[model samples]
Target: MEQNNMQDLLKRYLEGNCTPEERAQVELWYELLDSKKAAANEAELEEDLAEVRTRLAMPFRKKGKLFRYPAVAAAAAVLLIISIGSYFYFNNKPSGVPQKANKLLATDIAPGRNIAILQLGDGTEIALDDQSNGAIAKSGSNTIYKNAKGQLTYVATESKEDETDNPVSNSLRTPRGGQFQLTLPDGSQVWLNAASQLTYKISKTSRERLVELKGEAYFEVAKDANRPFKVLSKGQVVEVLGTHFNVSSYDDDPSVKTTLAEGAVRIVETGGHRNVVLEPGQQATLDSSNRLSVAQVDVSDAIAWKNGKLNFNQSDIYAVARQLSRWYNVDVVFKGRAANVRLSGEVYRNTNASKVLEILAFYNLNCKIETNNGVKRIVIE
Candidate 1:
């Protein structure tokens, strides 16, 4: 290949877009680069490796290979490719960096500010984070209370309009890595996840109940079959008469997932393009391309965050890093290839940063934990 063609091939190889033959050529090109020279471009080298590894993970149907054990198989394939090139590339470099050390990016979501702003219908904003957790407002004979645990609740108060007491609604949002619980006017319970926002409006006892969510949340909605409950996520809407379920629709996430625990729910995407009727114990995933898929998953695992547990079952390194980022409020940067290390475990939600890092370290993954000026940086191996 000419110089330009070689450069394009290198770029494509690093982006995980190269074919198997192109991959072989990449090894030869890396062999031509002197290690002393390459070491100066260490960061670029790592990026290229990440992209290559990502491409290796793609399924190869032509190979007639079953996709079972995708992560392990992909890791093995990438390792084979790296072995072909590393002989020439690293022999000339210094031995200070361990040959077997895996450099991984420790990408994590920043910690929550333990902050929330309540927007009432009257356009009043209440800074919930700074206030003492207690009864903060009253609506239509219903008392609004915020507990020390950061949960908001509503209780019935005397009403002059009729025998039945009406409920009120308000907006609640938790900043990144923070969580709060809520009891709606209709006696429905909601647990907001980090970086989540929800809006609830008051309703008469006989009217429909509606709310909006951005990010993850667990809902134990009050049962009133006469009045259906609807939750609006970014581009999808979940409508249920009375059900217990969880919905994750973080705009940053690639897909919208809704897991149902009990009762029934109708998940509808915008423009009436996709619709799914989910049953209890069923989870639905809506991708950016508007494809809908349903599968059976353990509801307990899906809603573990609400119970103060970080549960993982056969989860990959990237998935684990995501959970840690949300729970501990740190940033995770992987230094090199993050292998297909499947883990099944649980950690207490309130565990300190070092403890979490120590647990991750046991997985053959190196981690460097540092805190500077209240910001935590977690570097992965």
Candidate 2:
């Protein structure tokens, strides 16, 4: 639609006369707005919106007034309308509706934290969460410690490596609503996301560095000319001399994704029959059928958990829901037909899950959080 018509539609939406389909589409555009750093509090935003309703009707609803001012300006009615209109015009979406947003509860479900368990070669498990920073344990020839800086590191001396002719193996695993960073004996750093695990084995007798992964992890591998770093996840293996990359191998996901951030990586299917090389900003996905496809991607989406953000940019409802389920430790159920909507914008990792649900529900009109049998869930219609 034309920008002028887009502006008129915004006026009608605020007047509460939009059709259901129009309303849903407009709200989807609202979700696309970048409010991650909005200076206004929730209450203030709502109050200003009420005033905006009156002001929108009185003036500036005239034809072609859209985009008369700078965007990302405060949620002033004219500016927001213009911004939304511009988005609609450029993206080829029809004009949509508006509704008073409902307030989100400060629900008990909190965000994920730095928590994980370390299992030694001797079969001993150490709870790393709530443990004070200090020397944590000794595994084979490796002395494991959690430094004051909160990095879990292992120190292996040459003599100790010699003492252990047999390889020493250990695993670091994170549960739902948990995350962690581990520095391997060879100095490669791995950041494990929620519901993920990384297992590594090292030996002086071995020539290569290898680690097995389940779920997702970001790696900053330490370089050694003699030893190439290799990551083995379901269906695929990634080999790099020394580089930064992220691997997501969730069992529930249809594909295992390996994203290269800083260096080159060679990815091979488990059978070693198919292979692909990736450059920075590229990704290789191994599907359930063992077919591999390469493409360029936004690397931030792959490592957003490590960087402390939840991204919804150009994402479907199910994709956004899966991230929330992992970080909030909740199950999502569809009450009727799933919303089948897409979302955009990035939320602070620190924000409560309820706040997100509120925004999502505001646009979709049929999503909310509830507790049944003491288990938290997001019910979608």
Candidate 3:
């Protein structure tokens, strides 16, 4: 594979002075060189390669000093090698390749649109929409308000005599593509991601800090050794005390993923398993294997959706496609054997999905997008 040996092989093959097997070896090396050069200018490289192939096919001419100009040919050979190298790198690399960048897709769910609702204890409903900044209403002694970012904040009125009321729950609901943050009556903070819901009561009067979650949410539980914070997701229960963690138990997704960012959490399954403890940077999953699996992961990426970005260090095409479908509300299909395609990189949640697909196509992995029955579907080209 040295440069000199490669050049000698090419020269011999072009001169039609090598055996059939030797000629094949030279042709393979030339193809590899062509690919390397193509990374910069694919279209132009294709043209040059075609012309060089024609010249190479013709019988070699004997000029005294012509072979001295191997530099020109060497440059071309390296370019081809790089291009082919890129192809193999992408195709044969391990899963979760970072080359397939993330893109924002068109959705039944659009970005930056606010759609959240609040329900009070006595069954009173507040639209939360069209509510001006600052105080919106009062529930008992607490004043409900909206901040500049449209998050709901509750301020309890000061009174000379303290009296605690029975625990009554209020719920925060976020529609698809919507997210909002709130501090519960108990001073515990909850960040609700798209299409998620959390129900909690005010802190002091409540016996313990408890919240029920559907979909995804990041919790920063207030430390109350006497009153443990419990998060109920589906039939699973996660108990924590003054810790930071993210839970993704969306019914639409196959598994319930609980990633611990700080402190510790005890996850309880429905089938009478005592508890599974998670450490920081650890993820516990209730996968299709009917077993709970735990592993160390990049905690930041596991919770990136809360920050309005899709961060993929090395993700497979299928996983990326599934994320796009959920975020953009699209369906994806594959026409070719794209099983080995891996992608990397990050993208904003607000960009168009088509642009991302086009970039992938540039890498020789083609994709076609179509609209069907008012739904968008993408197929591998």
The Cα RMSD in angstroms, rounded to one decimal, for candidate 2 relative to the true structure is 9.6
Best by lDDT: 2
- The candidate with the higher lDDT, 2 or 3, is 2
What's the TM-score of each model vs. the native?
A: 0.66, 0.74, 0.64
Lowest lDDT 10-mer window, candidate 1? 96-105
lDDT of 3 by residue, 1-381 (tens): 433354345434333355667756756755775656645444545665674576455443345433321222323333343333344323444222123322223332344345578888888777776677888776656778888775787778787253357566788887765678887655777888867889877646555777899988898887989888999886578999889999988876778899999999999876765469999999989865447878988787778777666654446777777676656656678886776755543445664565455334433566656667877676774
- Evaluated at residue 274, the lDDT of candidate 3 is 48
Backbone clashes (count) for model 3: 30
Q: What are the runs in model 2 whose C-alpha is more than 4 Å off?
A: 1-103, 148-150, 157-162
Best by TM-score: 2
Local accuracy of candidate 1 as per-residue lDDT tens digits, 1-381: 533253234334433466768766755443344343354444434544444356445564425643322332333233332332343323433232223222222322233435567777666788787778678876665677877778788776666653334455578888667888888878899989887899887867647788999989999988887888999997889998788999999887778999999999999987688799999999999988878889988787789788776766567888778777766666778988986776555444664554455445445567776557867677787
Q: Global lDDT of each model? A: 0.67, 0.71, 0.65
* Model 2 CA lDDT for position 147: 63
Q: Which ten residues in a row have the lowest lDDT in candidate 2?
A: 67-76
Specify the poorest-scoring 10-residue window by lDDT in model 3. Answer: 95-104
What C-alpha lDDT does candidate 2 achieve relative to the native structure? 0.71
Q: After the best TM-score superposition of candidate 2, give how far the Cα of residue 171 lies from its true spot, in angstroms.
A: 0.3
lDDT of 2 by residue, 1-381 (tens): 354455445434543456767656555444444352153224334443444445434432224454221111112433343322234333444433222112235345789888889998889898898678888888767778896544799887456343676898999999888888899988999999889989999676688999999999999999997999999999988999999999999988888999999989999998878999999999999998999999988787678778887766456778777888888877877776666655544445766775565445424446667778878887767
